[model samples]
Target chain A: MISRHGTPEHLPVRPFVALVALAVSVATFLWAGTAFAQASAAWPRVSPITIVINQSPWFGGFSKVVEAYEKETGNKVTLDVNPFAGSGEKQRNSVRSKEGQFDILVMNSAWLAEFYHGGFLTPLNTIDPAFKLDPQVMSYDDTGYWDAARKSNNAKTGVVYGVPINGNIQVLYYRADLYEKAGLKVPQTWEELAANAKALNSPPNVYGMVQRGARSASDISYDWMPYLHSHNGAIFKDEKAGDFTVTINSPEARQALDVYVNLAKTVGPPNPGSYGQAQVIQALLTGKAAHATPVIAAWPQLDDATKSAVVGKVNVAVLPHGPGGRTTPTLGHFIGGIPNNIPKDRQVAALAFLRWFQSYDAQVKYAQTGQPPIRSDVYAAAFMKTPEYRWSPAVLASLPNAKMMYTVPEGPQIASVLELRLNQAVLGEKTTADALNTAAAEIHDLMQKAGYKTARLPPLK
Target chain B: MRGTADRASAKAADRWRFYTLAPALAVYLLLALLPIVNLATMSVHDIHWQQGAARWTLVGMKHYAELPRDVLVRAGLANTALFALIAVTAEMLIGFALALFVSRIAVGRVLYRTIFLLPILLPGIVIGAIWKLMYNPDFGVINQLLHLLGLPGFDWLGSGSLAFLSVIIVDVWHWTPFVFLLLLAGLETLPQDIHEAAMLDGASAWQELRDVTIPMMVPILVMTLAFRLIVSFKVFDEVYLLTGGGPGTATEVLSFTIYRRFFTEDRMGYGSAISVIALFLLTLVIVLFMGMARRRMHAH
Candidate 1:
């Protein structure tokens, strides 16, 4: 009977042990928490940010800026610079898939609208109001960004989703020596340009002109947009409208396509339909093509010791006007945006790095390395006045007049259809009207398949 | 005495079973079966890189339905099949000819075998890059040679048809040695008495090869062909490093298409759908080949 009574005492003893264990655990956890808080407070907040950039000279320059930023801000940044070959669509899909691999991305203006609308990117508006109000830290000036870049930043969700990293506009490059030899002045109109191209072409050796004809997003659209805009054929009904209607079959657009086909067939290289950006640049640099419409970013390659043959002789100018009496070069600027996957500390660090990288001083530093800066003041700086960039001021001046390419949710698919038609047209497999109609049909089908409503454009007056 | 013998027989059987089956079964489960099972599971799930989670909801037949509409996918599948058929056939014929030629050689047989096997020792990517440079339109050795010969230089990779043929040529150059090595081993191991008897019976060299030698070598030939078929169907590195499925989807294979959909398009579910389809096709081919091989072995 006494042993049974002692069991109750043992039970109380076990409860006491349990309580003691719990108290120790709580004390240890609190101590560790305080220690961690102190350690973290002492350490400079290091955020791991990943920046995805399209391959170009500008990206090369940006890498140096990133290095400087990491050194100054105590942030860890992983720079992923993918080459231009398949990167446009790859980046788009990655963002759409919500691959949090990127904290910041340098994307072309054409992708801005799609990425913004798809909720792939975070709005700057959602950022801390304090960060938005800091004039020195964050300034959203319409003039600071080029006109086309500003328009592209107008997200369908009515929030700014991108900031222009650098200017990437198309400009006409011609061999001054060849133009002089042919007694041709710089062409002011598409007709004059075609005539000059014909006059300068020497078959099987020297091509008159070249542009990207490869079947990818950038390759097809970069070469085609200037023609479309010059003919006054808009991709959508209006910039503000969210409708996806394509006016590719408009008379002006067909005429533009016809002109393009004629140029590629008669004056362009024999295999213009298969040429890519590299080939097109090579043709101009190797003196095989008298003229080409290349992204201004490629202009620096003309002076590369290992690649260029016509270093001093090549000149850059705005693309020739078409029937509309205006030449709207397509904007291919890379925009910087923050990824939302990262923690708050990392986001702040990344934003700091971005702010420092886009500063006036950093922009000038980039200009010295052959990348044209996004800021207008950077162009007027002394560094850009050097002999290496004697033509940069004029190139910079052309950005405001530039127009953004068509931005659609299914931009790549639409680009692919157009690429196929352009190839067929260049190969003389189909007439301009036939190719445009087919392309329009394919684009319509693709949009519908992607769950976008079929858009009907208002008839042209 | 009967009990003792029964115990001894059981021990021997256990030892034999352990020695023969354990290592192979372990390897199959670890290296092959596990991955195959994992891939099969991944095929049904949508995966992407987002916030923190990488995979999304189950998208069963969505990707399969989209396959027919994808022009690149169709082209890639067709190209892969064509490449497999052409490369396998060419490699077998060329490899067999070299094996027969080397087997007859009285001098430098070892040297010839060593040299013939050199390309197989080289890495696929290295071979691909070397061939890419050679096929370059401007300043490439091929065009330079053609220019010297007073022939117009052709765009090897620029043209779709030519690019497909160019990749096959490179593959043949690299893998014909693999076939040759297998065939040589079979030829060298053959009983000398049969050839001697055929020759004594007044059988011509052609007749001996076609009747005695080829009939004996059928097992090895079938084995090599099956192995090469599977390898050629999964041709990814060479084509990827060389053309990157370009000059506009001209040389894209099914594997490359799947990779693009998975990594480039970020349509992991769609990519897995293609992978499942590829897996099924490959398994069917393997089973059919194995069945044929079993029949051939039984006949022998």
Candidate 2:
């Protein structure tokens, strides 16, 4: 067997067997070593979690943060992205299923009340007694807390159910270059804003302003909230104070309507009633709109060079106030909560992810993705000093004065009625007074039917 | 003895038939009848979601009582009726014309048929999104063409006056091919000698169409129109994607109302009530059309 090479063709049988055993032993040793390292280095007790989220302006940043979390924790995370309009149904179906399809549920503020009152979420404190939300995290009116007895979202008397993930609020976006060129001061009041809009308006080129007046998926009603609140008007007598008197047709509301409708008709793009969140943002990105008060989440897309034509040319400011009122931007935050229907293990894992999500370190990572982090301290992080995050200060300042559009479970239904009426007024289908009056009457009826002590309050003097 | 035996055998045959149909009938009852029954039950109650389960309170037809006063219901019913009327009429006329034109052509008929059928082949959602982009005021192809022609560009889906008509146009574009295909099949099956006799008798094309083609095609025409009308009543996607039943309540229809109440507003009992009413109306329309068709068949 060894004739060609002048060596033993094969080792002696015992030596050959020993050598084979040695090779196999080394192989097993290395394999066991790697496996032990993997088992030790991986998460102590990892459970794969799926999050149901809607496609939004902040989705890319959210996805990036999730990827970072997966890398750091060695846990599998799946993001189930759905259309913004369809996300509520997706979340509802998931929660209602026998075994929940999602571990994490991302809810918009408009629908948060329903979920909160429905008791779909397991309170965070119940999952882990030691886990507490970071003090610096913005509460967006303490929506994270739910008072089961009061059926209300309250910081003082409620338990922690969800954590704020997105600090979205409407802020004034304007073309800085145009403002500098025109020598116009930044508007601080509704009247001042109207004047500024009039000064810059030029049709088919650059409009003074654009408003989201479309009746699509809560767009028009949400866009009108700042106007209503800043004008000292309210949907109810006071939603948080247990007063459900319908006051949407108050004189202050009429004044707000006048301001809103006048601006849209006189200075906004043609057929402003058709403009939605997408259209308003598109108008700003294309430089066709000089100003708008879109949600702050859209700030990232405004400076994105690929999608925006007005990169670095736009600036953010606190939304202007109305006469006799203070700045009150509408809160539009997204919250993450664990659905009660999921397995306990999955809930614990989801809670772990949410706990880490609010940590100072994770907040910084999120801010680096050019999206607003829910934690207030992250606004002062080093990465936020970059030009890409120029809008952070304005958002931080605007958040303290932000108000929930409504705090009751009937908020969405009420907003639907207002959406139609407000859109009708914007399109001149009805007079502002008539529209508000009709909406007020309908809301009163709805509140009455919902077993509330509601009154159709007389219009204010 | 033979009669009695025949009667006994018939009873056995009837029992066999019932046994044979039992599975399919059960499936149909479970899938279709049960849901409608549940919907009817839900309509008479108040449903609230607590956690993952439903809590239903007996409301004693209160939701149905409120329907007559519901603003959206009134608006939806009016808009749905108008939409069905205008859209179905336009579709029938255009579909009839196209079918007649394609039937007369001696060559390239397949190409013509294929070209016309492309719109109906597309999914409704795709049709809705495409039409929405096309109707965009600033950069849409329709407005761009208007601008290029030195004509004023109007917001098609944005204007309160034009929004409903704009949706109707999209529906006509998407479904005219359906009517055309049905009518073409009917025309092909039509006896050719009658048309020849009419032509030989010095009847003009209009005369032939009116007296021979139309009268003879009544059954197919009724069937197509009824189908289109029923479908048009359920129009939701175009209204949703284009204008969202806006600039105001300009395009809100029955199905949109049901969706708003069911999905958006989360008023399940109220939504079920509206759905039951819609189903009843559709059922009535079906009955009326079936009766009309039977009468036409009997007359022929």
Candidate 3:
């Protein structure tokens, strides 16, 4: 079997195989080096992150924003939108199971404390090492947002839990035409509001004021907080207490309740107690109600010129003041935070997306699409110069006087308690004094049950 | 000696049969009994919801003890019971009458039957949304109709009593078709000669229905009633979508409470305890009704 060239045929094949093997090894090394070089050029391997949000109109254009983000960064993004009323429950369950299904939570500011208390939220600092919020994004109108939005860690250390994506406040939405027709100025006080409502009130045609008095507790109570605040009533005595005293059963609160009930019973919808935001929005847009309150984020749809009959007639103003002074609206800002248990990669992506979303440019885009901007600079930005959003100026003017609801570990739960009692008053099931007193008792019991060191103080004056 | 061998072989065959069923029994135990066992275990512990199955602090009988004291749980139970009792009775009576009328019709009987079954076929959530819109205060079709007739429109889901009644009416609307279809099937199978003979004997319509139809249809009636009871006890969707246990706990039922306690409150231990009790009660009621039915059938 020897070849004429002087070596065996099989012996020559061994050297040829060795040469091919050497070439393959060299090529593999070069290919790997090229891949590493490209990777070093940009952080390329960002896994998909899922964000859980409620189905609010403010989030209407979010899918497009997400698609844009995904296209720019080659990373997949998932949105898990739940109905607003049920989003809290879904988020709480996500917290309980510590599932990595949701990397980010776009939730109510009222819910931040509970999620933080339960160790469901990741500290904003932990989500990124090189994170710096625009100073404008940090506060507005001298509102120090770190304390405004809890400055604490799950281990009870110094940390920020969430960033405010929306600086939402309640505004009184009124039919300017109706006020003109009735020869009434925009009511500035509770007495004036009541009188105006009584004057314009007509059954089955144009009832006076509309109120959300439904019994879901949080929804109904959030709107009613401004009324109590305008009357100088506080739901709790202190925010930092382990167990706070309930001081809601004040003469001021009773008076607020009396006004609320009288408005609802005399001039409001036939079943005012059944009214939620949906009903209120319908009433306001159709010009069925002469006035409405706490018309939050809903102004977009209610004032859409093509969609609404009252487009040119609706005006925004401060909620009616009380004897205490001008009314202070309650804050239920939409806040965004990462959950504690998602992958590190997702944590980075979520933080990047959040910062990009709340950027001044993004805020302009959001403002143009009817989303309220969280930053003060967004107001001074060129977008705010033009009035695409009719409600922006009023929102900015109201910003200085806006106040955060109690940021306790059980704020929403306690909010519901306030809601139920206020609702009972609105429904005439309990006298104002009795309703507030009962709510105070229940609030005390709830605080005690949560293992708080509790006390109950009498209402101020 | 031969007979003894045969007997031993028969016993061995029986053992083989049971062995053949072992794989199915094992799967059933894993899929069904394991959750029940897990629920019982959870009910005993103070569950750290975040660390759910991985960790727990043992606190026996605490949740069970609290069940009786919880006002919401009691109200939910009462509402569920009242909903089942009233809804089932009305559905059965109306379903029976409709079934009889349709069974006797000589023209367009198929169309009538199809129309009656439409509500039952629709998704509960869709039905709920439709009802909620119809119950709206300002622009609901019902209110519009009333206004046209120069009558005042009532706030249907606004008042406590009215909210409860409206939810009941919706449930009845959704499920009465189920009763109608089941009873109609039974009516179709009934022999016609019996009715003809009753007529020839000069027995009035009422007499024929009371004496002959009642006795013959008892089994179907009982079975339909039993099915309706089981289904009604589990009502959640309509109540949830329509009233959400509001204007204030007016329509909150056991199932809705279970969801709220577990998911909303994150009280897994307490919620599981309630779930265990609910499962047991529902099972007992179904079994009791079925057992009585079986006994009555055998006696007949």
Q: Is candidate 2 or candidate 3 better by DockQ?
A: 2
Query: Candidate 2 on B6-108: residue-level lDDT in tens?
Result: 9999999999999999999999889998899999999999988776577899998899999999888999999999999999999999999999999999999
Label model 1 with its docking quality class.
Answer: incorrect
RMSD score of candidate 3 (Å): 9.7
Candidate 1 residue lDDT tens string, B1-300: 999999999999999999899899898789987877777677777654333235366766777787788777898889998999999999999999999999988999999999999999988768977887798777789999999999988888767668788889999999999999999999999999999999999999999999899989998999999999999999998877676666556787999888766654445566778888898988898898899888977887
lDDT tens readout by residue for model 1, A1-461: 23554655434576788999999999999998776576455334456877777777567677887776565445678877777645566566456553455677676665554455444665554554433312322222231222233334332224554566777788888888887877889887778889999998897678887867665445755698888888887665554445667677788887787778778878987667667777798888888988888888887788877879988878877888788648778877777776555556656666665666667766767777787776777777776777778668567657767876655545655665676677667756667777777777777776665566566433323
Which stretches of candidate 2 lie above 4 Å from their native place?
A: A1-43, B1-19, B197-203
Weakest ten-residue segment in model 3 chain A by summed lDDT: A140-149
Candidate 3, DockQ to 2 decimals? 0.28
User: What C-alpha lDDT does candidate 3 achieve relative to the native structure?
Assistant: 0.77
Per TM-score, the best of the predicted structures is 2
**What residue pairs are clashing in model 1?**
A98-B49, A98-B50, A99-B49, A103-A339
**Judged by lDDT against the true structure, how good is candidate 2?**
0.89
Q: Which segments of candidate 1 are over 4 A away from where they belong?
A: A1-55, A67-103, A108-128, A132-152, A155-161, A234-240, A401-406, A456-461, B1-66, B106-111, B121-125, B241-252, B260-262, B293-300
TM-score of chain A of 3: 0.82
What are the chain A TM-scores of the candidates, in order?
Answer: 0.80, 0.91, 0.82
Error (Å) of candidate 3 at residue A7 is: 67
